[model samples]
Target: MKERKIALSQEDFAKINKAVQQAAAKGSKDSLILYRDLALVTSITNRTVITAIDGNNMAEHVFTNIDSAVIVK
Candidate 1:
Protein backbone atom coordinates (compact mmCIF):
# COMPACT_ATOMS: atom_id res chain seq x y z
CA MET A 1 0.00 0.00 0.00
CA LYS A 2 1.15 3.52 -0.74
CA GLU A 3 1.39 6.23 1.87
CA ARG A 4 -1.63 8.49 2.06
CA LYS A 5 -0.54 12.11 2.13
CA ILE A 6 -3.63 13.74 0.69
CA ALA A 7 -5.44 16.14 2.93
CA LEU A 8 -9.13 15.46 2.54
CA SER A 9 -11.77 17.73 3.99
CA GLN A 10 -15.07 16.59 5.44
CA GLU A 11 -16.89 17.72 2.33
CA ASP A 12 -14.51 15.68 0.24
CA PHE A 13 -15.36 12.58 2.24
CA ALA A 14 -19.05 13.28 1.80
CA LYS A 15 -18.65 13.55 -1.94
CA ILE A 16 -16.58 10.39 -2.09
CA ASN A 17 -19.06 8.47 0.03
CA LYS A 18 -21.89 9.55 -2.18
CA ALA A 19 -20.01 8.56 -5.28
CA VAL A 20 -19.11 5.18 -3.80
CA GLN A 21 -22.70 4.52 -2.88
CA GLN A 22 -23.79 5.33 -6.39
CA ALA A 23 -21.21 3.00 -7.79
CA ALA A 24 -22.27 0.24 -5.41
CA ALA A 25 -25.85 0.66 -6.52
CA LYS A 26 -24.66 0.00 -10.05
CA GLY A 27 -22.99 -3.27 -8.88
CA SER A 28 -19.46 -1.98 -9.20
CA LYS A 29 -16.86 -4.05 -7.39
CA ASP A 30 -13.98 -1.65 -7.78
CA SER A 31 -14.05 1.98 -8.85
CA LEU A 32 -11.76 4.79 -9.81
CA ILE A 33 -12.68 8.14 -8.34
CA LEU A 34 -11.32 11.43 -9.57
CA TYR A 35 -11.67 14.47 -7.37
CA ARG A 36 -9.84 17.68 -8.00
CA ASP A 37 -6.27 16.61 -8.85
CA LEU A 38 -6.40 13.35 -6.93
CA ALA A 39 -7.29 9.88 -8.13
CA LEU A 40 -8.39 7.10 -5.80
CA VAL A 41 -9.21 3.44 -6.26
CA THR A 42 -11.92 2.11 -3.97
CA SER A 43 -13.65 -1.13 -3.19
CA ILE A 44 -17.36 -0.49 -3.16
CA THR A 45 -18.31 -3.65 -1.26
CA ASN A 46 -15.65 -3.16 1.39
CA ARG A 47 -16.02 0.62 1.39
CA THR A 48 -12.29 1.00 1.50
CA VAL A 49 -9.81 2.98 -0.55
CA ILE A 50 -7.30 0.75 -2.29
CA THR A 51 -4.88 3.40 -3.43
CA ALA A 52 -4.55 7.14 -3.92
CA ILE A 53 -2.52 9.07 -6.44
CA ASP A 54 -1.83 12.76 -6.72
CA GLY A 55 -1.78 14.79 -9.94
CA ASN A 56 2.00 14.97 -9.99
CA ASN A 57 2.23 11.20 -10.41
CA MET A 58 -0.89 10.64 -12.53
CA ALA A 59 0.45 11.27 -16.02
CA GLU A 60 1.86 7.82 -16.61
CA HIS A 61 -0.39 5.90 -14.25
CA VAL A 62 -2.65 3.19 -15.58
CA PHE A 63 -5.62 1.88 -13.65
CA THR A 64 -6.78 -1.71 -13.90
CA ASN A 65 -9.52 -3.99 -12.54
CA ILE A 66 -11.91 -1.16 -12.01
CA ASP A 67 -15.46 -1.75 -13.18
CA SER A 68 -16.51 1.86 -12.90
CA ALA A 69 -15.19 5.42 -12.71
CA VAL A 70 -16.61 8.47 -10.99
CA ILE A 71 -15.44 12.04 -11.50
CA VAL A 72 -16.36 14.38 -8.71
CA LYS A 73 -16.18 18.03 -9.58
Candidate 2:
Protein backbone atom coordinates (compact mmCIF):
# COMPACT_ATOMS: atom_id res chain seq x y z
CA MET A 1 0.00 0.00 0.00
CA LYS A 2 1.11 3.58 -0.63
CA GLU A 3 2.05 5.65 2.40
CA ARG A 4 -0.64 8.16 3.34
CA LYS A 5 -0.09 11.55 4.89
CA ILE A 6 -2.69 13.46 6.85
CA ALA A 7 -1.96 17.11 7.45
CA LEU A 8 -3.06 18.46 10.77
CA SER A 9 -2.65 21.82 12.47
CA GLN A 10 -0.94 22.14 15.84
CA GLU A 11 -4.31 22.56 17.52
CA ASP A 12 -5.62 19.42 15.86
CA PHE A 13 -2.52 17.50 16.85
CA ALA A 14 -2.93 18.57 20.46
CA LYS A 15 -6.57 17.62 20.43
CA ILE A 16 -5.81 14.16 19.02
CA ASN A 17 -3.15 13.59 21.63
CA LYS A 18 -5.50 14.60 24.41
CA ALA A 19 -8.23 12.39 23.02
CA VAL A 20 -5.88 9.42 22.82
CA GLN A 21 -4.83 9.97 26.40
CA GLN A 22 -8.44 10.09 27.54
CA ALA A 23 -9.30 6.97 25.59
CA ALA A 24 -6.36 5.13 27.09
CA ALA A 25 -7.46 6.18 30.54
CA LYS A 26 -10.90 4.75 29.81
CA GLY A 27 -9.36 1.29 29.08
CA SER A 28 -9.26 1.64 25.33
CA LYS A 29 -6.76 -0.39 23.38
CA ASP A 30 -5.63 -1.14 19.83
CA SER A 31 -7.19 1.28 17.33
CA LEU A 32 -8.74 4.64 18.12
CA ILE A 33 -11.27 6.50 16.00
CA LEU A 34 -10.96 10.28 16.04
CA TYR A 35 -13.36 12.71 14.46
CA ARG A 36 -12.25 16.28 13.91
CA ASP A 37 -13.57 18.06 10.81
CA LEU A 38 -12.74 14.73 9.18
CA ALA A 39 -12.59 11.13 10.33
CA LEU A 40 -9.26 9.62 11.36
CA VAL A 41 -8.43 6.00 11.98
CA THR A 42 -5.44 5.73 14.31
CA SER A 43 -3.47 2.94 15.81
CA ILE A 44 -3.14 3.40 19.54
CA THR A 45 -0.26 0.97 19.79
CA ASN A 46 1.60 2.48 16.84
CA ARG A 47 0.60 6.02 17.74
CA THR A 48 -0.08 6.94 14.15
CA VAL A 49 -3.06 7.75 12.01
CA ILE A 50 -3.54 4.87 9.62
CA THR A 51 -5.94 6.73 7.31
CA ALA A 52 -8.28 9.69 7.09
CA ILE A 53 -11.50 10.54 5.28
CA ASP A 54 -13.26 13.83 4.76
CA GLY A 55 -16.69 14.28 6.28
CA ASN A 56 -18.33 14.33 2.88
CA ASN A 57 -17.13 10.80 2.11
CA MET A 58 -17.59 9.41 5.60
CA ALA A 59 -21.11 8.18 5.08
CA GLU A 60 -20.13 5.65 2.45
CA HIS A 61 -17.38 3.99 4.44
CA VAL A 62 -17.33 1.50 7.25
CA PHE A 63 -14.73 1.68 10.01
CA THR A 64 -13.36 -1.44 11.58
CA ASN A 65 -10.67 -2.58 14.03
CA ILE A 66 -11.29 0.37 16.32
CA ASP A 67 -11.48 0.03 20.08
CA SER A 68 -12.68 3.51 20.89
CA ALA A 69 -13.83 6.80 19.35
CA VAL A 70 -13.17 10.47 20.19
CA ILE A 71 -14.95 13.50 18.81
CA VAL A 72 -13.08 16.82 18.67
CA LYS A 73 -14.86 19.86 17.41
Candidate 3:
Protein backbone atom coordinates (compact mmCIF):
# COMPACT_ATOMS: atom_id res chain seq x y z
CA MET A 1 0.00 0.00 0.00
CA LYS A 2 1.13 3.59 -0.64
CA GLU A 3 0.25 6.81 1.08
CA ARG A 4 -0.82 9.74 -1.04
CA LYS A 5 -0.34 13.34 0.00
CA ILE A 6 -2.55 16.04 -1.36
CA ALA A 7 -1.07 19.47 -1.98
CA LEU A 8 -3.64 22.11 -2.84
CA SER A 9 -7.40 21.69 -2.42
CA GLN A 10 -10.25 23.41 -4.25
CA GLU A 11 -10.76 26.17 -1.68
CA ASP A 12 -7.07 26.88 -1.44
CA PHE A 13 -6.85 27.03 -5.24
CA ALA A 14 -9.79 29.45 -5.27
CA LYS A 15 -8.14 31.87 -2.87
CA ILE A 16 -4.97 31.87 -4.96
CA ASN A 17 -6.91 32.12 -8.20
CA LYS A 18 -8.94 35.03 -6.83
CA ALA A 19 -5.79 36.95 -6.08
CA VAL A 20 -4.48 36.44 -9.58
CA GLN A 21 -7.80 37.34 -11.14
CA GLN A 22 -8.19 40.43 -9.03
CA ALA A 23 -4.69 41.48 -9.92
CA ALA A 24 -5.28 40.99 -13.64
CA ALA A 25 -8.52 42.95 -13.58
CA LYS A 26 -6.92 45.78 -11.64
CA GLY A 27 -3.79 45.94 -13.85
CA SER A 28 -1.65 44.65 -10.97
CA LYS A 29 -1.00 41.43 -12.82
CA ASP A 30 2.45 40.83 -11.57
CA SER A 31 3.65 37.37 -10.66
CA LEU A 32 1.70 36.23 -7.62
CA ILE A 33 2.76 33.31 -5.45
CA LEU A 34 1.80 31.87 -2.07
CA TYR A 35 4.45 30.95 0.45
CA ARG A 36 3.94 29.46 3.87
CA ASP A 37 6.17 29.01 6.89
CA LEU A 38 4.81 26.43 9.29
CA ALA A 39 7.01 27.80 12.02
CA LEU A 40 5.38 31.24 11.94
CA VAL A 41 2.01 29.82 11.03
CA THR A 42 1.39 28.07 14.38
CA SER A 43 -1.83 26.91 12.77
CA ILE A 44 -2.86 27.15 9.10
CA THR A 45 -5.24 28.85 6.70
CA ASN A 46 -6.46 28.54 3.12
CA ARG A 47 -3.26 30.41 2.25
CA THR A 48 -1.15 27.41 1.36
CA VAL A 49 2.11 27.71 -0.50
CA ILE A 50 2.55 26.73 -4.12
CA THR A 51 5.87 25.21 -3.14
CA ALA A 52 6.84 22.52 -0.72
CA ILE A 53 7.95 23.53 2.78
CA ASP A 54 11.59 22.80 3.36
CA GLY A 55 13.24 23.75 6.69
CA ASN A 56 15.84 25.65 4.69
CA ASN A 57 13.49 28.53 3.95
CA MET A 58 11.37 30.82 6.10
CA ALA A 59 8.15 32.20 4.64
CA GLU A 60 7.99 35.85 3.71
CA HIS A 61 5.11 38.04 4.83
CA VAL A 62 4.30 41.22 6.66
CA PHE A 63 1.88 40.67 9.55
CA THR A 64 -0.11 43.23 11.49
CA ASN A 65 -1.64 42.29 14.80
CA ILE A 66 -4.70 44.37 15.57
CA ASP A 67 -7.36 43.80 18.18
CA SER A 68 -6.56 40.06 18.38
CA ALA A 69 -6.71 39.66 14.62
CA VAL A 70 -3.78 38.96 12.34
CA ILE A 71 -3.45 40.50 8.91
CA VAL A 72 -1.07 39.08 6.27
CA LYS A 73 0.66 40.81 3.43
C-alpha lDDT of all candidate models, in order:
0.92, 0.71, 0.35
Ranking 1 against 2 by TM-score, winner:
1
Displacement of residue 59 (Cα, Å) in model 3 is 5.6
Q: Provide the lDDT at 12 for model 2.
A: 77
Worst window of 10 by summed lDDT in candidate 1: 1-10
Model 3 per-residue lDDT tens digits across residues 1-73: 0122335568755655565454445543233333332212211223333233323443464433211222123
In candidate 1, residue 36 scores what lDDT? 92
Which of the numbered candidates is closest to the native, going by highest lDDT?
Answer: 1
Structure candidate 2, residue pairs in collision: none
Model 2 has an lDDT value of 0.71
Error of 1 at 57 (Å): 0.8
Q: What is the C-alpha lDDT profile of model 1 across 1-73, one tens digit per residue? A: 2375688889999999999999999999999999899998999999999999999889989999999999998
My TM-score estimates for the predictions, one after another, are 0.93, 0.75, 0.38
For 1-73, candidate 2 gives per-residue lDDT tens digits of 1333456778877888887777777777655455565777777766777777776667878888888888766
> Candidates ranked by lDDT, best first?
1, 2, 3
In candidate 2, which residue ranges exceed 4 Å CA deviation?
1-6
How many residue pairs collide in each prediction?
0, 0, 0
What's the lDDT for candidate 1? 0.92
